[model samples]
Target: MKKPELLVTPKSVEHIEDLISSGADAFIIGEQQFGLRLAGEFSLKQVNEATKVIHAANKKVYVAVNALFHNDRLEALDEYLMELQRIGVDSIVFGDPAVLMAVRELNITIPLHWNPETTATNWFQANYWAERGAKRAVLARELSLDEIIEIKENSQPEIEVQIHGMTCMFQSKRKLLGNYFLFRKEAMEIENRKENKNMFLHDKERKNKYPIYEDLNGTHIFSPNDMCLIDELTELFEAGIDSLKFDGILQSDDYITTVTNLYRQAIDAYFDQGEEAYEALKDDLLEKIEVIQPPLRPLDTGFIFKETVY
Candidate 1:
């Protein structure tokens, strides 16, 4: 089987080299205004600079132009796509049709990875975008293992899945958290709300505390446990997944690099020696990841082993 490309979101432009050293084959990054849930924002200049650096290392860079746009925001987007093309990025990850329209109107040639998050669940949806020009389908995190395999087996575009890091559960354009604080007349700074990594919403019924924060995209919430699919890598690779993404949102650079290296080692082991090598290393890798991950942010297989809602 061909080895899957290991993709990661860098914490910042400065962290790109470290992530590259940790064995990341490709990176997904963008400014906050255009990307809904990014680890950090990069100016267009930074995107140009970083793209050069990535290409120098013989790695790929994918810019996120995946935000839902307003009429006002649409004006700047066409130019942005053109600039990205000029910089020669490997691909653009997009959710909104406006981005695709802009690309076509500007005659931009950069490839697109369709990442509609929750909505990209089945083969028909995957092919619809592929037929329109998306080169890859970043499947929904909610898909069960069987569903993911089936989709890959039938879908025309290459498949990408999140193999590690936090999973976003909710997002909104309204500043819900800030409004709540305002309702209570609490004295909270806007920056505090934007950078509040300690904030969470507790679900008493599920007994889970979802990480929550507000940003330019408004309010966003994450799953209770970070998704760690190290154990399931074999299945994904064997099934012909083209890429595996590791989100670095809400994680320290050290943590992100460490976790990435662990996966790197595992991927190399599996491909170099087959399933038996991966099996022998799985237990030890999981133990290291358990110790390395933040105490509050637990790890699980996400929806891979769970039943999907119809």
Candidate 2:
């Protein structure tokens, strides 16, 4: 059984040490101007400091340069990527070609992780980016378990998957929440929208309230059920994924620590004792996860088990 690297997005530079201790093998953190919907943003100086800390622990740190860039943002990008390279970031997660161009221009040696999200569903797309210098591909969350395994088997780039946490369903580059408040003639600060988790969108027919919020990039909505795959770790390990990401977005530090530890244990158990022992522990793991996760956000395997998602 291959042991995959366990990745998580830390809430802050301060949380890096704790997450490292809790068994995260790599971290994804970035600034809001360059990254979209990140769990936490760090100043360039803070990112330098973070890289040092992660290196000291013999773990990896990846900066998210994954935003859909505009013209203004591109001007500072080359400098940002250069600084990240100088500070020794393990790799960068990016969705834009501008970042690739900037990396080429600066001659930065940092590996690129292509994460175009929904478009990263097939082995061909992963290989296309691999040929262009991307070292890894963060597979789209919409992929089924079998789809993911097939990609890993066929793709040239190392495969990464989001196996846990809140999965975003929609993102728009507009202040949808703020515009709604304005339409109703209510007052609310546009910048404070991300903090307002109490706000949600109810599907008229389905009656499911999907969590919604806004930040620097735009307004975003998440799946009603959070993704949980503790029970499926054995299959993913068998598939030989390069990394497993546990998104810490919209989650507390305690929750992050608890869940990371659980997954870490599950990963070790599966490799150390094999599938039967891992299966025996799955029930206890889910029981613990349910206690920490928000009561309203039920846990499901997301699109992993679904036959058809469209």
Candidate 3:
């Protein structure tokens, strides 16, 4: 099996060098106004600078324009895409079919990485995207290992999976956070009360809570625990995944460095010495991840083992 490319989300230009040094083979840089992570968005100038940095290390950079676009934004989107193509961006990751069509219509030739943001659960979906000019498909986080293996076996496009990071459980375009605060303004002393900076939601029925955040795309409710697949590198490699992605846009630089290094070590160990070495390093890697991850954030295997309920 070919060794999977190690992809990482670098929130800023400052993180690019460290990410490259940490063994990242490629990066997914968020667009300033059109990416999922508003907090991690980069200006066009920053994107240009970041691309230079990533290319200097001989690694690739994929710009994230994965937000669903509206009719009003089509002109701007076309212009932005042309600008990206001019700057030699390696690829554009997008979720909207209209945007993909726009890219094609504009004759923008940078490869597309289709991230439908939901429901890329099978090989047929991957093949569908491949037939439509997508070079890669970021698989949905809801699939199990066996399902992923099946998709890899049947798909035509290169497969990418989020091996470590937050799993978004819910996403909506409405400004829920703003509306909530507005509605509650009269219920309490609005002006004097501090906004709940550390925002989260507790599910009474599920007896769990998840991190919540709002941005240009809307409100996102993430899974209760961050996904940690440090122990499953061998499975992913054997399954023929083309890339393993680390999502750290919302995490600290130290956290990104530690997790990236852990995965890097695990991937290198597996490819060089085989499964036994990979297994032997699991505990040590997990310990390090725990140490570096935010104290309050929990880690779990995510939906890799069990199917997510509909």
Give the top-scoring candidate (TM-score): 1
lDDT of 1 by residue, 1-310 (tens): 8999999989777899999999999999999888878887899999998999899999999999988788978888888888999999999999999898888999999899999898998999999999999999999999899999999999999999998988888889899888887888874665465667678898899989898988777788999999998877878988999999999898899998988899998899999988899999988988899998888888998999999554
List TM-score per model, in order: 0.97, 0.96, 0.93
**Separate clash counts for every candidate:** 0, 0, 0
Among these predicted structures, which one has the highest lDDT? Answer: 1
- The TM-score that candidate 2 achieves is 0.96
lDDT (10s digit) by residue, model 2, range 93-151: 99898898888988989899999887888999999999999999999999889999999
TM-score of 3: 0.93
Ranking by TM-score: 1, 2, 3
The C-alpha local distance difference test score for the whole of candidate 3 amounts to 0.83
Would you list the clashing residue pairs of candidate 1?
none
lDDT of 2: 0.88
**lDDT values, one for every candidate:** 0.89, 0.88, 0.83
- The parts of candidate 3 lying over 4 Å away from their true place are 186-197
Candidate 1: stretches off by over 4 Å:
none
CA lDDT of 57 in candidate 3?
86
